[model samples]
Target: MAKAPVAGGYYPPVGFHFKVEFVGIGNDNDIRFQSVAGLTVEYDTESFKEGGENRFEHKLPLRTKYPDLSLKRGMLTDSKVIKWCLDALQNREFKPAQINVILLNEEHQPLKTWNVYNAWPKKWSVSDLNAQDNSIVIETLELSYNYFTVN
Candidate 1:
């Protein structure tokens, strides 16, 4: 028997620094975000029972669920993100946008990419102000997407 090759002195990529881009309708140009979170995909399983089956159970794939994506950054004067959210809230016919989350390597190059399809802003919020504490105003945008793909 032959043994499998083992990797030596290899380190995995860190997830600290990354960039996000919003593409498609409502956003003519690609918009970059400061930070991204809640990028996840999950699926439900459907189990079946057989009459003459052994102790083992059979399972099948079910519906897939994509969780909402949350983006946060320091408050900016730009109104693009806000406008998109407002349009969806006010306009009767709103268009979905494509979002891209790019993971970067230590050299600031893209290591992995995640594409979010048919995404629309679901919620928008801003951080509260404090009288004594000194902190930059932060804005958060939450989005709902049909599905996401990793590449």
Candidate 2:
């Protein structure tokens, strides 16, 4: 995402300066995300043709479809967000929650926000272990959300 302009001709906030929150989860680890992806929506369209004309087909817009959301962070031994995801995926008990991705300025003030609604974990995975390469193990959590609002 490109940085948006700020007041007083201030430069745009860097992408690395941001915060993520899983609303009401009450976990410190939940807010520290290394990366967030898949905050996008596209309209589903249908094409219609008239019997009498040979012109281009009319395009009709349908409901909006949101792609799955992905959050990544360093591996943790314990996390409430992980437990919630496990309960839904492992125990077949699904519970949805809201997620907020906030882009912050130099002062850590929110420049823009994306509120994801009714998000439930769809897939969880950890990075591959390779002794040859030295890197922190990252855990990725994928979720399917109904929709997101930008502000």
Candidate 3:
């Protein structure tokens, strides 16, 4: 079995970044990513009306703007992960809807990875994380991720 060079442990430079192609279903294959950070997008919201009589009413056909995305994790609060992501997006090496995340630990080894999507924020930004791995501290200076996507 071939072992992944940067898996199961931490890697160096603490602050490492990379990019990967985002392959999705359908004809939207035009999407590509060069880095992982500061990428932005918009979300959609809606409302409805109910009841009647002489006053019962509500607002409809409404729209609002929000940050392209938001990321929150309980593993750590030092902001190192957040800062790294922000810098990657601002580097001008990547694009929206495509990013790669290279997770690392205290020793700077790769931990895990994921593909970012417009709806990914709602899923990853949970209040608390239930990482099943005990080899490293959940909220310690270990276990970091580098996000990016490819074309």
Candidate 4:
């Protein structure tokens, strides 16, 4: 395996970026989700430009300032990201939107999965999104909590 540069373990080689979209979240924890409206991408970057090392923080605004992650304290784990992504794609709990995840491997294979909250967008389409075989594309949504039960 090629040695992937570890930017908090999310692979920050200036190329591993994932373009994502929010479809909506599950019903139980849904809120008015504006975070998953447009196209957003998650990148493993140390700095906004380059050469700096600030770590990869989320670009989109979350509903909760802190997450209720049932863990003591460390760094924001990868599972948290996956959970956040899952929650933001539900319509009943979150605002309505259509979500489509496109995954790309090293060889550049487009693996697609569509998640719809209330409904899928007529205009939001999916196709082969190859990032030049340098990185992988993970489709996910950025969401906020109800602004009340956030820890």
Taking every candidate in turn, the Cα RMSD to the unseen true structure, in Å, is 6.0, 4.1, 15.5, 17.3
lDDT of 1 by residue, 13-120 (tens): 777777777764324232446678877877788889888998977888898998899988786675666777778877744678888888988678899999999988
- The candidates, ranked best first by TM-score, are 2, 1, 3, 4
Question: Taking the tens digit of each residue's C-alpha lDDT, what string does model 4 give over 9-81?
Answer: 7742222322333434333223212123432233333324334645654344333232211111122234433
TM-score of each: 0.80, 0.87, 0.24, 0.20
Top model number, lDDT: 2
Q: After superposition, how far is residue 17 of candidate 1 from its true place, in Å?
A: 1.3
- Candidate 3 stretches with Cα past 4 Å from truth are 1-43, 52-98, 116-151
Compare the candidates by TM-score and give the number of the best one: 2
In angstroms, how far off is 63's CA in candidate 2? 0.7
Model-by-model lDDT, in order? 0.78, 0.91, 0.36, 0.33
Q: Residue pairs in steric clash, candidate 2?
A: none
RMSD of 1: 6.0
Candidate 1, residue 60: how far the Cα is off, in Å: 1.9
Q: Could you tell which candidate, 1 or 3, scores higher by TM-score?
A: 1
In candidate 3 the C-alpha lDDT for residue 37 amounts to 42
Model 3 / residue 60 / CA error / Å: 11
Q: Please, what are the lDDT tens digits per residue for candidate 3 over residues 13-99?
A: 444433232334113221221224444333454535565644545545444333433332234434433334344445532222433
Better of 2 and 4 by TM-score: 2
